[model samples]
Target: MTTMPRYLLSVFGPAARTDYGPYPSKEDMLQAFADTGAFNDRLQREGYFVFADGLEPATTATTVDGQGESPVLTDGPYLETKEHIGGFWVIEAPDLDVALALAADGSKACRGVIEVRPFQTAESVAALLDS
Candidate 1:
């Protein structure tokens, strides 16, 4: 039997998509959330979904580095951009083709671009099993 390859599904949506605006009407904001929620529900139905999460706006983010006791903690994003990584998922599939398909599906669900990268180990399978 062959083991399936695992992949990282990095989902990037419109930076302000989650903002939903400070709508004048409460109903307007509610409707926007409904649409996003429905999309998330669909992803749950798909077997390709291994895990999923959303991120807070990059506005409040701070960069950090170095050791814990004296780690360098910087304000603002390390790299400024209109968009951030947003969220991601870890999925196991048969091959690159399948992974890409899943990524496309995720993009549709997230209403943005989804990049899929196959996870690889520097050592061969035999080497891992022997260790």
Candidate 2:
């Protein structure tokens, strides 16, 4: 049997802001949230949804490094950047075209930029491990 391809739709925003960037007003932000919730429901009904959630501000993140003899804990995001992933949705789709279409709608719903990317297959990961 063939397995469906998986994609990650990441929502990007400023690192300092927890909300969905600058909105004209509080009502606009609330409308965005409502739209996003409806979009998520549609994804679930269409059987493309896997997992999705919003994340806390970058200030609340903790980074861990375990490559050395001892694990190193660091505060803040792994990368210091003006933008960061504020939320994400993991979805299953037949192809990239479909994923991109879905991401476009998601972008509008959340009032944020959506970055679409495919997950590496298990076979590809095994090949990398063996190399």
Candidate 3:
């Protein structure tokens, strides 16, 4: 017997997609939100969704590093880049092909790139420890 592996789909893109300006129209924003919601519904109905969400803008983030007793905090992202993660999803799939297929849809829904990564299971960790 086999168990399906859990995967994470990390969505990345610019804060906004505007070729001529800094923001999209209110109607376009609402439409995108609605489309994303409908896409999430499809994932849930298909049993592929475990969890998913969009994140607040990167400007509201704080980065922390170092030891717990004396951790350092920074005001911005760890790396300065044109693109940042806007959202993510946790899903279960039998293999990479299936996961990528789902990720493709996710990319279309969010109008961004999706990075697919498989989660490490406890069984694999235990086996590694015993080795």
Candidate 4:
């Protein structure tokens, strides 16, 4: 059996804010939410959706480091950057072009910039391990 290619559509925005972009009013924000909901429904109906979610602000994040003898816990995002991933969607597509097209719609729906990346397949992982 052939497996579909999985891609991650990450929504990026300012780390300080939970919302995607500047909304002039509450109605605008509600409209954005409605559009995003419609997009999500379309994805599910089309059979390309795997999983999707919006993340909280970077301030609410906790970082855990367990590589050393004792684990250390940090209260915040792992990276201190101007922008962070505010949300993400995991989708299965036939190819990169299709994934990119979907990402375009997703970006518009969520009113945020999106970064599309493909997940490494099991075969690719095994090849890397062997090398």
Q: Which candidate is the best by lDDT?
A: 2
Clashes of each: 0, 0, 0, 0
- How much lDDT does each candidate structure score? 0.67, 0.91, 0.82, 0.90
Model 4: lDDT to the true structure? 0.90
**RMSD values, in order shown:** 5.1, 2.3, 3.3, 2.0
Compare candidates 1 and 4 on TM-score and give the better one: 4
Candidate 1 weakest ten by summed lDDT: 15-24
Q: Looking at model 3, how many pairs of residues clash?
A: 0
| 1-131: candidate 4 lDDT, tens digit per residue | 99799999999976554243445567777997899999999999999999999887888899999999999999999999998888999999999999999999999998889999999999889999999
Error at 61, model 1, angstroms: 2.0
TM-score of each candidate structure, all chains considered together: 0.66, 0.88, 0.81, 0.90
Q: Write the per-residue lDDT of candidate 3 for residues 1-131, one digit (tens) a residue.
A: 86689999998878555642222666666666777798899889988889998887677799999878899999978888888888899998888999999899877776678899989899879989999
Ranking by TM-score: 4, 2, 3, 1
Mark the regions of model 1 whose C-alpha exceeds 4 Å error after superposition: 1-3, 16-18, 21-47, 67-69, 122-131
The predicted structure with the larger lDDT, 2 or 4, is 2
Ranking by lDDT: 2, 4, 3, 1
lDDT per residue for candidate 1 within 12-122, as digits (tens), equals: 644554335323356765764565566556555755556667666666689989767788989877887666777777877777898887677666555557788877765
Which candidate number would show the highest TM-score if scored against the true structure? 4
